[model samples]
Target: MDGHPLRLALDLLKGTLALTVHKIRYGLASRLWHGTNLVTEQMSRHTQQVRLLRAGEVLGSLDVSTVRDEIGSRRGTVSFNGCLHQLFSGQPLTRQEKALVLAQLVASFSLTTSYDFADSPLLDGDDRLLMREVLYGAGFAAREMRTFIYQSRQDGQDTTADIESKSTREQTRSATRKLEVVDVSLDEFIRFHDANLAQKHNYRRWDIDAAFVADALALGKARILAARGRSADGLTPQGIQAAMIYTWDDISLKLYRISYDTAKTANPHANKVLIARGMQMAHDLGLLLDTDCAPPGAAILYERFGFPERVRTHYVRATLLSKFAAFIRRDFPSLDRRLRPWVIRAVTRVNRSAA
Candidate 1:
């Protein structure tokens, strides 16, 4: 019976319902009842019993004041990955040393950003639980932590740490590539976006606020990336031939913006190079790669690159409904209006959020 399709469907439904209920309960307990302290305390005890370093010890290595200074002085000039590269100097670190550095970086950033380091998505589920306690017990907020972690992730520091071996290999090949994609400074990124991608995207602003972009880039340094292709003569650099913007959305590296200058550049691989770089970054970070939107033609390219496509049935349905909503509302007034309203709301939210 367990192998039967109907049985499987029932099991799936049951699991979804149970998860929904658990989330609701957790939300209420954590927010309304302030039950975070209990969980925090339990995690704290677990860490202590396991003989893990105390919160103070972990945080001592990367002091808060030092982080503050770095944030102030190096906001847009350096990336977390760049900093790690300088610190480790391409040397391999043991698992323990890596973890310690990750924890310290998270703690330092959390302190400066006024966010809970423990709740950072950079941590795996178990690590997040453990660090939640550590950070909370160390006087970081258990509740009301905000969006600083997202920015920290864009810096690509911790993720870079995880992929040091891969980066080292890529570094060795750097001398051979004549036209390569590279990290651009924020000003360069903004100018390229304004000139190239913004036009391609119809001057549509990415959902990211300009101020947020500034702040995130200042913090993460990996948020904006660009590439230069060959000039018309195919021998020299053609400035800003391709560009892209991406950020860590949970465990996925979501590519939100991309453009290539196919007309001016002699290099046909401009787009591919930019995309491949993003794929490599995703692989290094141990994250899946996704994009916000891809046109119908781009779908074929994504498929060729091994990205499985799910036809967004909701989009199809909403589009159909949008065309027929007034007609339906006028012709069938007595029919249930609830679904129309729900669909409209969902569609509105999606459109507003789209780049």
Candidate 2:
């Protein structure tokens, strides 16, 4: 039998009667109201149907009810899925609305990182501009220096780290190429670095990886100072010469440089020595404690510099970086809102943090 309309009407009537009777017996036990036996049975069946069927299925079902209830009875309304669908398409989004969504998606979730400096030479042109900015730092005259990463062993790590990347804004790359990893220090920042000032890269202002490297370099010197300080066994001459050059390289491959003004020079081990010296200096300056790395950024170097007694016996949680993602997403409506503003912020912040 075609019971569709009749079923809906019956369900309606059942709902109306249940609401009316329930009001009169507000505090009474549910069993005390078995008086409206048919209506009560219908309510049970309707509730079961609601539990078993999806919104669309329920609306399409013929077994719901047949009796039409008086107008204005308590009842369920149809569910809407179209709006939810549009939300995920990234077609368009209202800022506050999307912010609300993002907040729910990433509430307290931690994020990890990696970075790149494009994948082609400037001549080849696949995002070649990425080549320029990154190269400018490693070029004959680099202002400051830092490093980047392109996928590495991420197996079971707390905060996988990488520098931010750059893509040539205009033009395209002629062919695919590998990403370049680098080490960088800003030229503007160099002037402020002096014996009197604390390690200038505030952990809060830079990418997490840089902070670790910076922290490692900071803790490295002191332990060494107590034992070797620039003695023969300490930061090999090769590494020392290399450290003389400020660095910035592609995330995929490492970069090392030593040049005098506009003239280019090469001393491969110089960078290694320089990095080692930087670490030793960090310790010498007391910017970081020797026991910091088992927590995972700069501690091991401290021990390597000569603090064997320093055992980070217990694990320490990472609060290392500036916690950028969540902070930016906090006020947004959705965690994944792909609006231009949010996307731009995510892109800029992610690159800065990674870089």
Candidate 3:
């Protein structure tokens, strides 16, 4: 008999024993306290890693990486680390832990990390407090507060029906051709985004890339909606004029991006039709429709289409230098809050200039 066989058998036995012990402990802890701390602490200790913890259990982990397209730009981001809900459990980190996570992120990636936080009633109150304190302590400043909205499948169906009826009337009166909607491949979606939407706005920081869409598509996690139009010669296809990229969860289908041509002569009703179509698709799937983060004006547009404000989210960002300084400097606790208005104005100016 080979000694390797015995060794492998022993290793398998050890692994099985460890897993059994883990499950027993988790079960006991869960029964004892319906809360997560005990189990979460054990999980953190076992992994010896920093992770998003909730109810004392590890909900998820974060990963930081350099933006491939921004390789030379010295920009890095905390890419989508699992689903948004899993990572942001509303659990706040202790100051020391927050400092450690941020320091490690900056040192490892050599760039600041940014993420969005959406408020939910499900989160623990202390968790929300920790979120604010840690981000503020880490010198992470809040960006424009965007409204997140959703509509039920039934409401979506009703809205889509009304929009379709109106679109038909408008098409007949204006003699404007309605763009045909179709499902597009990842490559086609990327081309439309790059040509029509990428350069039109300074959305590099928030825009979804091809790799993300490709991975989602490969995993059967998303749907692509594209609008095909006629070319100037009225013969060849004009490629994608409007597109809506969306994904789903147990409850809702969320629009990730919506792009359309902004030329003056372009059909004014194109976006409305595309949006109505997206709603209809979500309805057919028996899921609520969610519009991603939108500015106040855009929120108004979503409301018109039957999506009402479901939640609000803020994009929080911090620089490595500022985060470090926050750990060292303890004076003027109110300074950041007091200067927030001015900072917002300054950032708005910079963004406008860049655009």
Candidate 4:
């Protein structure tokens, strides 16, 4: 009885109606409070376009024709531009259609790009395999493989005692004597982020502009944690030793973007405490904890904190020769078989040099 199609349809209908009502209520509230600004306008348009695209995708009607038509009609609009990549992300695409989308993505964002699809968590193995095949067929090669590790809410709970070891508790108390972790305002987060920009990897930069942070906060998607050293007077703190910026996943409520200050610090355990605090926050929120796109040696630290690796995905780039080889393979199949080995060797050399 619970598995009836009518029951499922009713649930879907209710969800759709609830979402529509929520959007209307939020729009009215925003108009009352923010009073309409350029940012608000852009956000509104973006939201509407995304909603349309999502609706199309969910109905299984978002074909290449629809994508091209929308792109043509909404060309240069903030809405379309904001979600152009997303338009194809959730749709089941043919190889040729995927190639076209990949071409557009390369043109808009360069040969190297990494972003979660619109329905990442919902994608099964077949979907992921298709996406991988599409990328491979589009001449992309792996750059770095990042694994996402998650701890279930139930598993994450009851770990307080495990985390607060006698040694760690003593150390934490001692560390807190000289240092404190505090919640930072958006403005403070921005300032700290900007100040530490030079510390981040040049290739793997996370865009942290004020508007983005503000929007994230408004949508309840982000949190900022800062560690400040205590003053001699035991009242005021000194400077920031570390800060962590974590964002929430809407569907899974999983935590992401678990970044911390990389600047040299006197206390080696500062980052550990910050990570522990992040886990606690996740537990408090009754959500899984997830960290994505970690740098080298980061997995070791995360493992130390009880987060085992779950999914490994790679950041890939398409080289000119690889694209040329792919083009040859597609256009001249006979030539491709004869030159495949040479092309592989050439690509390998180029990748090594680039690395």
Highest TM-score among the candidates is held by which one? Answer: 3
The per-candidate count of clashes, in order, stands at 1, 76, 6, 0
Candidate 4 lDDT, 77-136, residue by residue in tens: 111111112334455767555443433332222222122222233335654555555444
Candidate 3: worst-modelled 10 consecutive residues by lDDT: 39-48
How many Å off is the CA of 153 in candidate 4?
A: 6.0
- Give the C-alpha miss distance for residue 320 in model 2, angstroms: 17
Local accuracy of candidate 1 as per-residue lDDT tens digits, 56-143:
2321122111111111211111121111112221236554444443333332231112221112223345444554443333333333
TM-score quality measure for candidate 2: 0.18
Stretches of model 2 off by over 4 angstroms after superposition: 1-185, 188-266, 275-340, 343-355
User: Tens digit of lDDT per residue, candidate 2, span 57-77?
Assistant: 211111111110111111221
- Sort the predicted structures by TM-score, highest score first: 3, 4, 1, 2
Where's the lowest-lDDT run of ten residues in candidate 1? 311-320
Worst 10 residues of 2 by lDDT: 77-86
Over 4 Å off, model 1: 1-178, 197-201, 230-237, 264-266, 310-355
lDDT of each: 0.41, 0.24, 0.48, 0.46
* Candidate 1 lDDT score at position 50: 14
Off by over 4 Å in 4: 1-124, 134-144, 152-159, 162-178, 193-211, 231-234, 252-265, 314-355
Residue lDDT tens for model 3, 241-293: 67888865444566777777776766655666666666666677776566666
TM-score for all models, in order of appearance: 0.38, 0.18, 0.53, 0.50
Arranged by lDDT, best first: 3, 4, 1, 2
